[model samples]
Target: MSSEAKPLSGLRVLIPRGGPWGDLVSRALRERGAHTVTAPLVDFAHTSEEDQLVDALKRLEAGEFDWMTATSSTVADVLTHHNAVIPQETNVAVVGEATAVAFRDAGYHITRTPERENSTHALLEEWSEIDTGDVLKVLTLRSDVAIPVLTEGLIDRGHDVTQVLAFRTVGVPASVHIREDIESGRINALLVASAKIAEEVAAQFPQLPENTIVACVGVNTLEVAAALGLPDDADDPAHADYELKRALIESVESVIDQSDMLD
Candidate 1:
């Protein structure tokens, strides 16, 4: 189709996360003719137990840890907030594309990133391939609510793992105006990346209009949304921010085209 006749032309898409991620997704969608609305449903807060996190960072910078892994971009934010330094000897492994970008932006070199699935399980699956021999010390920075899958998995493989809480996810309520827009079917699609955002969406937009397309980024978030009764209208297997936006635009365009044919 012509540029002026882009698939997502005149569509309204709701982006769940804010900051650079939100900006990137919004720009990509807008370029595809979708009017993007950023309603941040979740925000990261400092870990409640500050001392433990601080001590972990100290050890990390002291070359005590042989490897450090960051599962989310938010972990990069936590590292930047504390001015935490990773010794040159410590190799870094990141999971998601956004997380990789965040670490690079924060001046850290990544040693490894999962090829296909950007989940903890995926990271562990490729752990043997990335590090053939057992490493002495490994530090994992993750959200408070995140499971200790990576740590547990690594320990099983005979590696010393020190997992630290880098941040906590707090929900942000959507404004009444945004609520009205979703209830009124003004939003053509809602995109979510985490289970926390899915919970917020489920709570805020209880009665989503039938025409509102719900798109999820990662497998965990998609499963969460499905469990919460939010049908997955569109999904991206890559779980990258850009890929998700592209999928949303393409899916909405298909729906619109089918509707036009019916009319």
Candidate 2:
């Protein structure tokens, strides 16, 4: 479609994560005629609990756990970085498509993922289907700042769960120009993929322009954004990049429609 015909033709969108995923998102936004800003707002660090993490991975490689749970791509990265192994007998459950892709990319097999929503609660809801046996051994890998929802939920279900901190999430401040654009309303929308990113955005941009749209990638992220006092003008139902782009387009169009109505 022509630039004028594109839904986001004159808009600028901020993608908060950088790397191959951010590049893909930027390309997708450009395809929709959006001026994309790819700024990474969060970075991963080695967990402070190194000994504990190493011991857990050693046990995981020894095939002591029946199932392993991966909640984020950072978890998969930690596993790969540590050269962890997953015996064929050990099944891997992921929280969402993104995590599944990350595990697969890291040469790990994914046994299960939430059929519907991409949240810990959704994973817990499908837990029974993943394992019918009672009192199974499960290993859950997560970031330092992550809530122990999966671990607690599995424990409540009568399973022996071992939760390990795989990495730490640290904030990366946006460049001065990017911050200025956001504060001045040059950026039309901000794509938030996780709660951590939402936290960073909230900390960095305390007051956003009324016209700026804060779009979250999933239900959990939307909840976090709401709690942090960030406006939830749009949300992607799924964690996929394409779905996020579609959500932005639809939201921008909705705003245009409302403005036209007022005029």
Tens-digit lDDT string for candidate 2 (114-183): 7655556777787674357668898988877776777887888788888878788899999999999898
Give per-candidate clash totals: 0, 0
Candidate 1 lDDT, tens digit per residue, 144-187? 76756677778888788887777788999988888888889898
Question: Model-by-model lDDT, in order?
Answer: 0.72, 0.73
Model 2 scores worst on lDDT over the 10 consecutive residues at: 254-263
Task: Quote each prediction's TM-score.
Answer: 0.80, 0.77
Candidate RMSDs in Å, in order, are: 7.9, 7.9
Off by over 4 Å in 1: 1-5, 115-122, 125-131, 231-246, 249-263
Provide the lDDT at 260 for model 2: 10
